[model samples]
Target chain A: MVEVKLFASLRTVAGEKGFLTDAASVGELLREAAERYGEDFAKRLQIATVLVNGKNIAHLRWKRTRLKDGDVVSLFPPLAGG
Target chain B: MIGGYMGKVLQVDLSTGAIESYSLPERMLELYVGNKGLGARLLYDLLPPMTDPLSEKNVFIVTTAPLTGAGAPSSNRFNITTKSPLTGAIVNSNCGGNFGVFLKRAGYDSLIITGKASKPVYLKINEEGVSIEDASELWGLDTEKIQEKLTAGTGKLVIGPAGENLVKYAAVFSQERAAGRGGVGAVMGSKNLKAVIAGGKKRVPVAHKDKFKDACRKWRQLSREHPATGEELPRFGTSIFVNKCNATHTLPTRNFLHGSYDEADAVSGETLAEKHLIKNIGCYGCPIACGRQVQLHGKNIKGPEYETVGLFGPNLMNADLKAIIELNYQADLLGMDTISLGNTLGFVMEAREKGLIKTDLAFGKIDRLSRTLDDIAYRRGLGDDMAEGVRFLSQKYGGEEFALHVKGMELASYEPRGAVGQGLGYAIGSRGGCHIAAGYPIYLEANGPITVDPLATTGKPGLVVLNQTTMEAVSTIGCCIFSVYMFLPKALLELNARSPLISKIVRSTFLYGGNIIGKALSWPAWTLPVPAPFFMLPQVQTHAHCTGERYTLGKMMELGKRVVSMDRIFNLREGLTGADDTLPKRLTDELQRAEEPRSKVTLSKMLPKYYNFRGWTPAGVPREKTLRTLQIEEEPMLPQTAMGAASTV
Candidate 1:
């Protein structure tokens, strides 16, 4: 099982903070999460970036990236301030 | 000549109470563009050598660009330019409101105010005429009340008690929006001017009517296509970023001593919108509609922006939304810059904790914050100390190591610990720690598609310089930077249509569908003229399906460069030597490890490189050659040449 955490606007769509996902692939995980959430969650995923251990998931492979037990995944949209 | 402007400049002399109208010199308009650029040139020309910022010698200008009040999306922003009482540098602060668009409709590209008003007075301009009216009745009133007393017609800009009292960090407000930084309000107070009530119905003139209309439609489509700006910003507003920043551990807290706040959710834009939002407000022709409307009591009020959420929310150690909202309202009413005030108050609280002062003004102390604000606005008790600004307070109280400021002005909400490049921008900004003046480092570090070490000083100098130059141009052209994300792809297509240089680049990206090139091009799109609220394009289209008119990029960049260089010249004239461009001691020396988990700022390492990148001497002085190239004369020997005598460095 993998733990996925959603934040900011993504959380508003995800409804819950953390969820358990047994899916092995990133795409399957997202598809399952979106099914439980709403169409907005799927739409937000296009802009909603995934972070693994504080690094962006875009830095890794997209849907093909495999998930492992104990791996922490976080979803976030862009936020900037100065 | 045929396709770019409204063609008129309005000069109002408060001293003699004279109103003069002139067709703006074509060359000046072409080169300076409007807002930041034009205002700088006008101020450089009009201001006497080394004139006191708060003296009768200073001039306060509100300027708009050709794009103002047009149907162009987010292109109607206006700027207020003056000498700053805070850092004694050239101060130009812009705000998104109805005033800029109204001012453009009043048939003037700019309004230059000089001399002292004989008494408490306000200036009213409309299609009929312009007059200086007595405003004793409006004195001591807050911004909401003052704005209420004015004619409900479009284009009224007013100052509140903070400006009237000459608070150094006071701001000039229009409706609920404010020209928040640079002490523009203090200059108004110094001149005994109360407020400016203006409205006009003149149509904004356009260049290239056919092309501009087509361009507008394409631009609108581009905006709707961008996921971040078109959807996110419009839905959640800037406060939406609050959660993102906190999640990344970059949300500034407790006077930038920390990057993440304990109660980030309480002040997040999502929370604000979900809990308190009554309505969403848009500036001029903006499609994003990010402004917040919240009900505090029975009356609706403008909610705290992102900076306010960070500064008053976490920086002050206060998390309750109601407290932040009330304080935000109070500051707005007082015409005070909430960012500066909150930062200053944080310094006081820290000082008190250290026993540097004999007060109990600790973090989360709502009473102290309230008392301090009243004091600063009225220049009373501890307020007098706070009014001296964070830097002076630190100096007097012996906490110089923890003073959170750059060039005397306090830093905005983002903690430098999370991003060193932003710290560099603050230190080197021409307008004393302004974020918008040059905030590229933050973009490069956190929001960019490109990856960079946020805590490193490398590459920051060049980045800061590039952002500053671009911002200077954008300000002059009179547009909001927020539109850059949404409008960039369209801007590129428009530029290619206008200039061959842009076409060559567009052809190189044939491999990636238009969208990939669109994202890549957004990085460099900072160079183009941005659309603002005050200056509206004559006609604008919203999507690819519609036809908007076209404008030239070459002309816009030229005007932007002119505005940036002119402001530099103004600062040089004001005696801002290399010594004046410096960060506060806190960022330079104090270790904020407890609050800021990853705090590491070495401003000393970057200042030299910044100077080099700016074509300045090793000492950080603008090179004589660079100044001459920019058409800025050498400092004129400073009368008896007592230059750098009072320099903090």
Candidate 2:
């Protein structure tokens, strides 16, 4: 099981702050999430930052990066400020 | 006057009650531009080196840029450059307030205030002349009250009790916004000046009226189109960075003992917008409207910015957003800088925890905070020590290692360990730990449209140099630095987010491009002649159109470089050295998380590279060749005695 946390506009789009899921990898978790949150959320996720264990997934293996039980995933829409 | 300037600068010398006007040399205007750069030049020339910041000798300058009142979006801002009692270094505080616009409208581009008044007084400037009015009734009033008591339909800048008591971080309020750092309000209060108000019917002259207007319209449209400035900022305000910074392990928590806070999301911009925000507000000509108006205690008041929220919330271990909101309002009304106030309180809390000092203040308990703020403002009890600022308090008590300040100014919300580039920024920032003066490099390192490796020290120096130069040039031209958010446009962000390979390429480009940009900055300004594309950097285009000057990206970069070097000279003159470019031991030696070995600011690795990139000596002093290249001299002219006066007060 993995804990998925959403922030910024992503939380509002997902209709929840977080959820517990049994997806085996980042791809599995996100594909399932896309189905649950809808096509609009799927589109939004294209522009959202996905972090696993506090590390940005872009530096990881992208969606191919694996997830494990107790691993935490956080998603944020692109943001900027001083 | 070419354009935008009122062609006169009022020099108000309270010691002799003389208000004189002088037309700044045209070469100086072209070289320094206006606002921060101009103010820096004026301060450097008018006040002797090593002058006491709180003494009658310190000079206070208020300067507006050409775009201040020229109907440009995000361009109506003013700057206050003065010697600061807090760091004893140069302080150039910029504010997105209407005072700059009104001052321009009142037929002056700048005001130079010097010396102390024998009694409490306020200065009024309008179409007819200037007056130093007795301000006994306005004295000791809160910022809001004093501003309210002022004449209506005019721009006002006022200080409250914190300033009057000489609290080191006291801020001056113009409307609800603040010129909010480095004891500017204390300088004002030291002069026994309660307020300064300006009003008039003068119109700002634009050299190319039609072109300037069109460029401004397009600039506003562009701001609305950019993802960061238009959508996210307008919707979330600055607090949106909370979740992003937390995810990146850059959020300051528990007085810098930790990075992420469990309660961070509770005080995030999303939470503020959902729970407390009444509406999004804008400053003067700002189209981004990142300011927030929130509901507090059945009344609506100015909401805390991200700095206030981060430092007061997670840094102090307080999850109560309502408390932060109330404290933010309280700090503003009391006319103290919330950034410094928050850091000071956090230091005290940790000191209390370690038994280093005895105080009622503690982390996660804010019950006494309101009264504590009052006490600090009034300089009563332990608040007297707190009024001396974190640097002084730590020196007097114990715990200097974790005091969380550089050169006396408190660090901003981004805990530097998680983003080491920002750590370098804080260390070498001209104004000593100021986020803006450090060029807001956290944007490039952590939460920008693109992200570079947070732990790498490879190209950070060059990146920091570019960011600082860009931010300085933006401020020099009188635009809100938020407009630079469009430098990373929507198309690039969407493309970056959509493709992992492209994102990698973009990040690598910035990472390595930093080195190239840094090297390029050392080359003669004339070597790069291309104007940045209008679509990409509309600010340069708008400035050229407004002022009818030939402005390219090269000139803008050069202007920024000149300002940076001038500040460095000013600091060096004030006895600051390369040794002063430092962060607290807590940030340098301690990791944000024990498990993350790379989560510490490696300042030593970046400092030499930064100095080299700026063409400065390894000691961080500007070389004589560089000074000559920038045309910064040892002296500039100031108006003489009474006859130079356009009118006397």
Candidate 3:
């Protein structure tokens, strides 16, 4: 099982902090999230950043990066402030 | 006269008790615009070189932009510009409050004050006239009480005991908002001025009313559609960055010794909204409503912003959110700047830990904070030293190595070790360790959604210039800095998320193409005269309509560059050389994490390139040609007697 976290507007759309997913890859996990949360969440997710274990996936293997059991994934929408 | 301008500047000489009003030169208005930009020009022209900031020689200006009181969203901002008592640099501190609106309504665009008052006094301005009234009774009052004591219908700018006592980081308060940085209030105290009240029924006119109205409507719509502005900011406020900054390791912890905090969530905006917030507040004409109104000690007060939370929270190793809230309120009531106040406390805590000073304050200790804040305002004992800010403390207490400041002013809450470009910004920022002045590169480096490598130093010079120029322009026009959030629209964010290839391209453009972009943009305004699309930034169109002047993106960017250059020239004349453009040893020499060898900021690698791109000499002075191209003239030295008057006062 993987723990997924949502932040800022992503959290607002998700209607909860996050959920547990059993998906094996980041792409699969995101797909599951989209299906469960509906279109608004999916649209927000489209602009959201995905981080695996505190590392931005863009620096890693994008969505193709594989995930393992007990891994934590966090999603954040574009945010700005001083 | 421009449609947005009141066409007059009020000049007051406290020493002589003389008040004069002069028409603003149309040429000067066209060249410098207003507020921060025009104020810089005025300060440069009026101030003698190296005048003591706390002395009567220092010129103090309160200025408004054309957009201010022109019915533009979040445009009711006024700027306080003067030589900083803390940093000895030119400081232009802007505040979002009703004072600017009412000041414009009272038939003036700016107020120029000079000389020391014979005694404590306050100035009251109305459609009828302006007067310098005795304020002896109002001298010791706190910010909240003084405004209430003043006439109800007028808008006020008041100082508290902190300013009266001349705390280096004392702030000028207007309503719940503050022009808080660089000890602007200390300058006011030096003048023995208590408050300035403005009230009138005059309306700010627009040049092309129909066009201006249409632009404003579209601008509001654009703001509403942007996710960052319309949703995230409105719902969560700026404190929402706590969790994100923590996750990104950009949250300053333990006086910037580390970047991550264990208890960040306790002070997060989510927690504030969920448990403490009574309602959301906003500045005049602001649609985002990003301000927080939270219940503290049975009273509803302005909640702590992100910087306050970080500095008072993780930076001091304290986790009590309640303590932070209360301290935030106490600091504001005392007319102290929370950013500087929190940083000072963090420095003292670290100083205590290292045996650099003998203080009872300890890291993570909460009980004495409220009393300590009071002590600072009154300049009592150790609080007196603390009131002098980190620069003085470091000099006297032998902790300069760990002093988390730049050029005298303390750093804001964003720890630069996690975002190295921000480190560069802090070091070279004109008004000391100001994040806004430094252009806030941490957004692109770490906190923003699509980011460059936080530890990378290669493309930062160019990126820093871009952000700095853009933000300077935005501030000059009296808009909230938050309005810049829409620069990266929802479509770009969506594209960044949807395609890794696109993200790579975007990130690469910033990381590698920064120099090319910066250099190209550094060209003369005539080379790029076209205005960017309204959707990209409605400010250009709104400005054009309001002033009935042709404004383009190039002109806007050029104005920003000129403003920055003008400030640099002023600082240079005041003896602030490139040598002073430096960060503390903590940021430069110490790595945040032991294992991450590249975690520290390598400022030397970026500063030279930044200067070159800015068309400045290697010593960081703007080149003659650069100034000429930007149409900035060398400010003439005004004689002492003529300081507060163009004609007479």
Give the clashing residue pairs of candidate 3, or none.
Answer: none
lDDT tens string, model 3, B1-649?
A: 6779998888888888788887766777887888899899889888778899999878899999999999988678999999999999999999987899999899999999988898999999998999999999999999999999999988899999999999999999999999999999999999999999999999998999999999999999999998888888888888988988898788999888888998997888878877788998988778888999999768889998899999999998888888899999889989999999888998899888898999889888999999999999999999999899999999999889888888898899898999999999998889989999999998888888879888999899999999999889888988889988878877888787776788888899998998887887789888887886787678878888999989888889998898999899999999999999898888899888898899899888999999998899999989999999988887553344445353332
lDDT tens digits, residue span B1-649, model 1: 5233555666677777767666655656555666777677677767777888888878888888777776677788899988888878888888888888887677776787887887899888877888899988988888888888888876778788888888889999887889999789989988888888767778775654665676676566666665556666766777876766665556767777777786888888878878898988877778777888899888888888988888898888888888899989988888899888988888887888888987767888786666667778888877877776887887788887778777778887777666677777777777877777654557655543222446656566656665565556655666687764432343332343333343334333321222232222222224444543211222222211111233334333333444555666678767777777666666666654655444677877778866665556777666666555444443332222111111110
Q: Which whole-number lDDT from 0 to 100 does residue A8 have in model 1?
A: 62
For candidate 2, the C-alpha RMSD (Å) to the true structure equals: 2.0
lDDT by residue for model 2 over B539-649, one digit each (tens)?
998988888998877888989999999999999999999999999999999877888898899988999999998879999999988888888887564545422331232
Q: What is the lDDT of residue B28 in candidate 3?
A: 77
What DockQ does candidate 2 score? Answer: 0.62
Q: How well does model 2 score by local distance difference test?
A: 0.88
Sliding window of 10 residues with minimal summed lDDT for model 1 chain B: B640-649
What value does the lDDT take at residue B2 in candidate 3?
A: 79
